[model samples]
Target: MAISDGETWVLASHNAGKIKELRDILAPRGIALKSAVELDLPEPEETEPTFEGNAALKARAACEATGLTCLADDSGLSVDALDGAPGIYSARWAGEPRDFGRAMQRVHDELGEAADRTARFVSVIALARPDGSISRYRGEVAGTIIWPPRGKGGFGYDPVFCPAGERRTFGEMAPEEKRQLSHRARALAAMIAAEFGS
Candidate 1:
């Protein structure tokens, strides 16, 4: 599962945020990343029930399309009070054109004065090879949702998610700061350790 320096891999995502974060992390290690959008690849429907399954599905699709190694991630915010209502359906909650503001409001509305505000961001990264082999890694960061959604920086539900031991939500943090604590970063770390070494 080792990757060599200077290898180009396809990122199985069209999300600008995820692509930037992954490129920032992997580029220094000498890996070049291209997004599915850049390659004009079709996005596969994520019909899997879990994060790992969905990630693998996307990665496999990209890998097969390009005959190149591919990386994909399935990530979401799960609220404890809601019993993880939007776990795998995170993106779907945002609807078309991805209106995260609406999704965040729905979370708050459903919560409706509930005492438990605990939640966690979950991510699973899947690496797929041209031959169809796949490896998956999972990461999570526990946090709580805040009302009145703070900052305008990060995409998705970052404005309301305050990680444990942090006063500010992810949206309030700089890109570099948020990257240090993001669920995606943690998952990428595990994948790098296995495929790209330290």
Candidate 2:
């Protein structure tokens, strides 16, 4: 499970935010990253129910399409009060074009009157070879949802959710700080450790 230095890795995602995050996470390790959009790869359908399933689905598609090692992640914010309403459907909550504002607003509306505001951000990452073999990693952070969005640094629901034991929302943290504790970063670190024996 060793990746050679200077190997090109395709990040199977169209989101600019995710691409930036992945590049920032892997760049320091000497991996060269190319986003799916950059490669003109079609967005794979995420029909799977679980994060791992979805991640594998995308990774497989991208690997097969480009004949390169592909990395994909499926992440979502789950609120205990909503019983994880937007677990797998987080991106689809606002329909096509993906409106995070509408999605976040809907989450707030649905959680109205619920005493519990506990929530968690979960991420599952899969690295797949063109031959179909795969490796996986997962990370999660427990937190509570703030009524009004705070800060403006992170994308998605970062402004409204604060991880447990943290005084500020992810959006309030600097990029370097957020990368240290973010679910995606945690998962990526785990994957790197497993692959490189770090």
Candidate 3:
């Protein structure tokens, strides 16, 4: 199915940062996003083993609940040095309140001066329709974890992720800049291109 201009889609996420980021990305296309949190939909447990699985699960849940077209994003950082320790568990590592500062510290401590700081951020976008059809797209960006986290922009592990070939971290980059290179943005672009064309 294709999304036309002015179509409304439910974003199956409660994170304010994610909602804002998605809104910014879709606004130019005249697509309006209503987040699940705004609709008072319950957050489903992410029991899926992979990003694609979790994204589809959440999108399907939201579509079933609201009977509307829904989108879900399951994204996280995977550090090569740690053998992708925080891949799916990135959010859990932060605990209930979602203190990313502590999570960043844990990464630093766990790394413990390892020479290899290579990491990559992965994003899977799942779109579910009321007709019970679901489609998924995946994007990834390689980067290295930096010490002493920089910048105040973006969220989650952005402060510590410096995408390959860039000296600045994701948090240090402007929204427009990040959008140009981020995994989430890439995934969204791929999905839109496939479904909506150009």
Candidate 4:
């Protein structure tokens, strides 16, 4: 396994919720993990044009900064009606202090009954060694948007997106339940199978 049991690695993210989700998946594999914020590491700007590129950018920056093996993910909601908008700008809509409520409202307003509420959450994860090259994995969850956010569990657009064939939005699902059906989870699972072989 490239990154296996008993190994401590850096998770290049500042979001506590994201870190918690990572632990929920990685901890059972006997991997000890740490986040960039936990280590007080600088977060690299996501300047890349695509999810894979952005993930690689962050992973490389974290690995170079701390000399630790790092893993990073870049994910966003892409609405078909919006022409795949709010893709890279997903985080930007959160504003300086990160208010997702406002972001959600903006999406609703922008969407305005376009008939096609089809959307998908896409995640690209990159694992980088101290030397900075990386292996990448991608995952996506297709769903449709529902007006007025639902239960409050996940961050971002979770409250309004209902996965295909499911009535509950991600925000309505428990953490473990979300893990079972999440873009991030799929990405992590793929990463494990690709690099760790388990």
Q: What is the TM-score of each candidate against the true structure?
A: 0.98, 0.97, 0.98, 0.97
Q: Candidate 3 clashing pairs? A: none
- Against the reference, the lDDT scores of all candidates come to 0.93, 0.90, 0.94, 0.89
Write out the backbone clash pairs for model 4. Answer: none
TM-score for candidate 1: 0.98
TM-score of 2: 0.97
For model 2, the stretches where C-alpha displacement exceeds 4 angstroms are: none
lDDT of 4 by residue, 45-85 (tens): 78889999999999998998889888898999999999897
* lDDT score for residue 198 of model 3: 79
Off by over 4 Å in 1: none
Ten contiguous residues with the weakest lDDT in model 2: 1-10
**CA error at residue 116 for candidate 3, angstroms:** 1.0
